[model samples]
Target: ITGELINIINSPDTSEDEHLLSVNFIQADTKGPEFKTTYNSTAQAIRIEFSTLELVLHQGVVLR
Candidate 1:
């Protein structure tokens, strides 16, 4: 997936500014991997790599 743009829309919590939590962990009354949140129009970068060749990864996020 070279040169592929991967949008990473992190709809953080309005209160704690935390990333979206797993639906199963929340009281969403559902049983699946779901994330419901809204993001601003500030377009962010789309980075995804499985190796250090494209970019370095410390914890699933690009380390630049």
Candidate 2:
């Protein structure tokens, strides 16, 4: 008979999810109003940076 060993994840807080740990992938799900606000703000910042890059490219073309 073949059997796979189970690895338990020990933490300070005890819970049922801790017992289900094994040598497998663990997907962490993080979702909330704060996360959404931060993500949207980060995307907006990147968009602003790219828009400035376009200005630099236009300047280079004009300088040529």
Candidate 1 per-residue lDDT, tens place, 1-64, comes to: 3666655543323445332332222233233344233222323324333221233334444544
Q: On a 0 to 100 scale, what is the lDDT of residue 49 in model 2?
A: 15
- Residue by residue across 1-64, what tens digits does model 2's lDDT show? 1364433333344455453234433222245455455454232232111111111233433578
Clashing pairs in 2: none
User: Lowest summed-lDDT stretch of 10 residues in model 1?
Assistant: 48-57
Off by over 4 Å in 1: 10-61
Model 1 residue-pair collision total: 0
* Cα distance off (Å), candidate 2, residue 58: 27
Q: What is the lDDT of residue 43 in candidate 1?
A: 30
Off by over 4 Å in 2: 1-29, 41-64
User: Which residue pairs collide, candidate 1?
Assistant: none
State each model's C-alpha RMSD to the native.
17.5, 23.7
Could you tell me the lDDT of residue 3 within candidate 2?
60
Q: What TM-score, to 2 decimals, does candidate 2 have? A: 0.14
